[model samples]
Target: MSDRTFTLDDLRRILLESAGAEEGVDLYADISDTGFEELGYESLALLEAGGRIEREFGVSLDDVNLSDITTPRALVEAVNELLSVDTAAA
Candidate 1:
């Protein structure tokens, strides 16, 4: 398994950097269960954030179904799962 783990904080930062935090949206708060749409992030913003995550984490997200990952927690879990697979393959 990979030593690296994708946390909420990391996702928050990347989402902020990729598309910026929405006004009145407290990204610092516990948003793991919050949907991206509820957080004011559109599909484009999410795609951008996913791109950033892929590049930074050195993992391919093409196999994962983005439509199913509607929350920060889901995204983080997907990324970490991919990281674990990568480590196992290596």
Candidate 2:
């Protein structure tokens, strides 16, 4: 992978693939956008998914900051932010 930009659809695809959801499952909307306690995803889904994104993109996330990750867009932004730091350092 070339560390290309990620979208909500991309994160949703990863979530669907990891969570074993079918094509009809609206993970990004129904899951990621849901409140952390309400969806039970903040515990690991977003964090692990974030780690995967970082690994796939050759970057690293500030994993400790996942407490506020309530949406795929947030995840994307976090990954992008981390990647930006990585770019700056490189």
Candidate 3:
């Protein structure tokens, strides 16, 4: 696993960059509470974001339901949980 530990800001930046770039949308604000669809993030955008996040964070989010991670905060929480599990395994 990666030794990197992500902060909320890091997660926010990653999500915004991934979704905005993938979806061609200007999600240039703090969207911690905003839903993905509301921010113009479709499945392709979200999946791309998830892939980037998984690769960057060194965690598998394959089992997580896409619908459950509608916002940046939710993604942060899920990533933290996965990181915690990795830590425990290590």
Candidate 4:
């Protein structure tokens, strides 16, 4: 497992890098509860972001249903949970 704790900043960076933020979207704002669709991120974009997260963080997201993770906060929580599990295992 990676020694990195996934944060909102990390998610923002990955989302922007992977799929580019929407034109009018303020990714820096408090978007924890904002839905991805509201933020102009489609399912495809989120999939790409998930892939990037898996690669960058050395965690597997195979068990996570991206569709269920509608908000950035949920995604961050999920990734952190995986990271915590990895930490426990280590």
Per-candidate Cα lDDT values, in order, are: 0.91, 0.63, 0.75, 0.96
The candidates, ranked best first by lDDT, are 4, 1, 3, 2
- Candidate 1 runs further than 4 Å off: none
Ranking of all predicted structures according to TM-score, beginning with the best and ending with the worst? 4, 1, 3, 2
- Name the candidate, 1 or 4, with the larger lDDT value: 4
Q: Which candidate gets the maximum TM-score versus the true structure?
A: 4
User: Model 2, stretches more than 4 Å misplaced?
Assistant: 1-3, 22-25, 28-42
How does model 3 fare in lDDT? 0.75
Clashes of 2: 0
Candidate achieving higher TM-score, 2 or 3: 3
Residue by residue across 37-81, what tens digits does model 4's lDDT show?
Answer: 999999999999999999999999999999999999999999999
**Is 2 or 3 the stronger prediction by lDDT?**
3
15-40: candidate 1 lDDT, tens digit per residue: 99999988999999989999999999
Each candidate: how many clashes? 0, 0, 0, 0
Write candidate 3's Cα lDDT for 1-90 as tens digits: 545666667865766777544355555566678777777778888788788888888889889997777887787788888988898889
Best by lDDT: 4
Can you give the lDDT of residue 3 in candidate 4?
62
TM-score of 1: 0.94
